[model samples]
Target: MAMIEISGLLLLLLTIFLAGGVWIAISLMACGWVAMQFVAGGIPAGAVLATTIWGNSASWTLAALPLFIWMGEILYRTKLSEEMFRGLAPWLNWLPGRLMHVNVLACGIFGSVSGSSAATCATVAKIALPELKKRGYDEKLALGSLAGAGTLGILIPPSITMVVYAVAANVSIIQIFLAGFLPGLLVMVLYSGYIIVWHMLNPDKSPPPEPAMPFRQKLKESAQLIPCMLLIALVFLSLLLGWATATECAAWGVLGSFGIAWWSGTLTKEAFWQSVMGTTRITCMIMLILAGASFMSTSMAYTGIPLALAAWVDSLHLSPYALIAALTVMYIVLGTALDGISMIVLTTAIVIPMIKSAGFDLVWFGIFLVLIVEMAEVSPPVGFNLFVLQTMSGKDSNTVALAALPFFFLLVAAVAIITIFPQIVMILPEMAFPPQ
Candidate 1:
């Protein structure tokens, strides 16, 4: 059979399995089985499947996923978001957007710890929406800003999405984490900048500025944030300074999260078990998906699908920029249906080769992939962040989707900026772990 025919057959099987409501992991495994059975008839598909799943599952680096997830789960049960709001509001009052900027800053802060976009959105929105609404802030702006900023969860350090991308791309987890920092900050600045411009044009829409806060009073109000700040410093600084590996840092993060929850009096027996259970469920789902993706990737390799696809892309003779433009559109379309992690795992086997063939750095592309995933978090239909805000705001999906539209474009702009100025994504990783 021709490569195109085989690839199309595998694609059809995958689509059919997924459309039939099979679990994503099973769907992937089923597709892999069909490919190996029909296309590579001599190989023992069952043994290959077992070994591939084991190899992917037993990765020490992959240990970071659950620890980071547990940390986020524990902190989500605490009053961290409430404290963030209280601490950040006084500082952000001078900004043109006033307290609305809290959504951006708070999401960034909480996202560093949480790593999950939906969790960050839900945690921050739980505290921010009611407060913003009560303060007479415009509902649309408040909801939209939260929907937009919430995506920072995956772009910042310790991101769950970044961890998955790093493992899949066979790059340094720390390098990917470092690469994401500046781009994440860039997106935040863009979001806040848009908020400022919006407020400037429609000053009447913004609430009156709160009274200037005394420095000491501000300090006192922000004291509750010291622990969270210290935790962030502990996890990130260890990674940056080479004191701990990503997994070690994640372990430390979990310990710090427990301490914070205890100090906040939210670490009750019930909360602890709930966090553990949440961690298990999320970890299991991700691990299964990784295993299935690994098996599928192995099957594709045996059948030469990835190399064939890469050669096809090369034959098109597209410029690097044009290739990136095409990929951005492809990912955006994928985003409309699939969640971010699935997008990364499903495509990396095919996409990474194309990117490498184009001479693009995997670490830089990891950040780019993450930024695109962040956009997916806000994309309609399956956009988890949109669903999060909708549930909290008691609004329909369209309202939440509309609110997130501008930020969606802002993410696209971030993608373009990084594509043109590739240095923005590479500088930190290069500085931290320079080429020999």
Candidate 2:
């Protein structure tokens, strides 16, 4: 009878659904149906469910996810990533942790190109792990950096996760992308810096051997990776300069990837078709999860779940940092169960309202949320990036898990930096796309 009673019941049902099987679509549909009865006083249930799912599923921006994903797939499987790795190998080898630098750089470059963290982890793992094993670099640094570094795929542009978050949370994709650029590079740089500094401080860790490269010869060989550079330049410039929509830029990226593969002589008919198949499969999975998320969001809205929670939290007058700490922990727990995109979808709806209650910038929260979720790629017990690495390397899972620890802290540190500074995530977005 009371609004409080109805809200409490809906929360109970939500918990039960999680226990039953986190079927977001079904959970939302079922919850929305009840909320419509109790909260909205009996709105049409079937019509609402069907209409909401259809409308949310029809978004134009959401389409950019799969296209960018596809582009990354084609480029990665084509060995363009290999070219980039091969080019950087000699240059990076001279440092301590010698070949592990390859893990970081390869992950960074592929993450830039691919836009999917798992793909970046897997793609680079296929190339770098063997070399890492052969060269006697510690497996911990090798797998850990890739597992941690792979998260950059979503932080950087062509990031479907950010794009979808922008669409769902009503933020700007370009702004999110711009917001992420410096931080993403900082993550890459910091990760690489850790390896170099660690090696420098403890010569045993990085034992410097001269990379078998004459500068001129290295320069000449590296030039062969011009296609990888061009691809990176094209995606960033298009988004950065307003030369194209993120979607259009994704399209351009797909075309550019194909061109690069063609030039690299890996663009065989079989590979192209196979890439298409892989893209379709991964994209379909993403879309299915997204469809389910949209439906659940619709249902949750009907129940007033998120709004009620926001109001309740606002009553406490918690400090911004305390609220953020709570949010970070929530994401880490949920992220261990769900993938990065789902974590953003499920949490942003609830978290953004609390964030806004605290008057933190939503754009900043979006970046912060992403940084936290991306950490799952390398985290333990369900670190998807760790598994991707282990699966690729045929190494024991424990070995890969141990390898990933350093980068995990590095990512946590990055999250702390962004959380505290705010400017780290906000400055570029503000500069690129001013407020309405």
Candidate 3:
């Protein structure tokens, strides 16, 4: 019995399980069971499964997942977006796209705070959509920018996706967080720059600028931005300065979110409980998937599949750039079916060996993978942000995808930039956390 034959069998079983409507986590575990039983018959399959799931599930670093999620949930229920729009509109109305820039700026800010792309898209769209429509702002630009900027939720520090990737790849979560900052900012700048350029070329696409407000008046109206800014600064600084562990920073975010909600008069007993419940559901789902992925990783190790695949890929002698290009395309295709986190967890165990063999930095690849996932968030059919914007805007998914298309390309451009100058992704992490 050859290893290839055993790998084929396990892959088939996993596919059938998935196509038959088994949950991803369950399917992964079942596949791991099948692999261990048949391919590595000498080992105790059930014992391995239990111990692997337990070990991965009990990680203290994983505690950050629920806390960050809770912070996002709490802030989601507040008037944060509404205030952001109010504060940002006056300041940005003089720009080429008028208030449409609000969508990009607000989502970037809120996404940084929330750490969930869907929440950022939904929260910003809930306020910005109707207001932009009423103000005669171009719907396409508004929708596109929102979809793109919302992805910043995962790219920014405190990102749930980054934490998952870090844990899976055995890298430093803080280093991954640091690595993402520049790429995230690059994407945001590209989105905004495209908006400005597009509006400049097609003037009528943007409404006539509102009369410029006095600088002092604009400052007064923009004061509402303070709380959101303070929260972002606190979460980022605590982690970057080594003042807190990732989990401790997440705790600080949750506490700050609660305080802000209370001051904003949006916190109720019901809202608090809702946030807690939402966090529990999301945390359980991610944890289960993590456990399954861990088991599956172990299964692949025992089967020698990952090592064999890496050796085969190495035999081809493909350059690092070529490998990254192939992966970018693969991830985009996979994005149509799997959400960002699932895509990372599903492939990392096997793909990582190949990536490391190419002499690429795992941390750099982590940032690059995240940028690809950000593109996935806005891809058609199953893009989480596309669905979110569709529900809010009452537009069909295709229409939403079309609206998001330009920003999608903008993400591709960011990927290209980072690939060409890997330092764009690595510099911040390297500078902040200099190697011993």
lDDT: which candidate is best? 1
lDDT of 3 at 384: 96
lDDT of 2 at 114: 87
lDDT order, best first, reads 1, 3, 2
lDDT of 2 at 60: 80
Query: Which residue pairs show backbone clashes in model 2?
Result: 96-206, 97-206, 140-403, 144-404
Q: Cα deviation of 373 in candidate 2 (Å)?
A: 0.9
* Cα lDDT, model 2, residue 89: 80
Report each candidate's C-alpha RMSD, comma-separated, in the order given.
0.9, 2.2, 1.3
Give the residue spans of candidate 3 off by over 4 A: 1-5
> Per-residue CA lDDT of candidate 1, range 63-111, in tens?
9999999999999876667887789889988889898899999999999
Across 137-158, the per-residue lDDT of candidate 3 in tens digits comes to 7888888888998898999877
Residue 229's C-alpha lDDT in candidate 3? 95
Clashing pairs in 3: none
Better of 2 and 3 by lDDT: 3
lDDT: worst 10-residue window of model 1: 76-85
**What does the lDDT come to for candidate 1?**
0.91
The number of clashing residue pairs in each candidate reads: 0, 4, 0
lDDT of 3 at 328: 93
Of models 1 and 3, which has the larger lDDT?
1
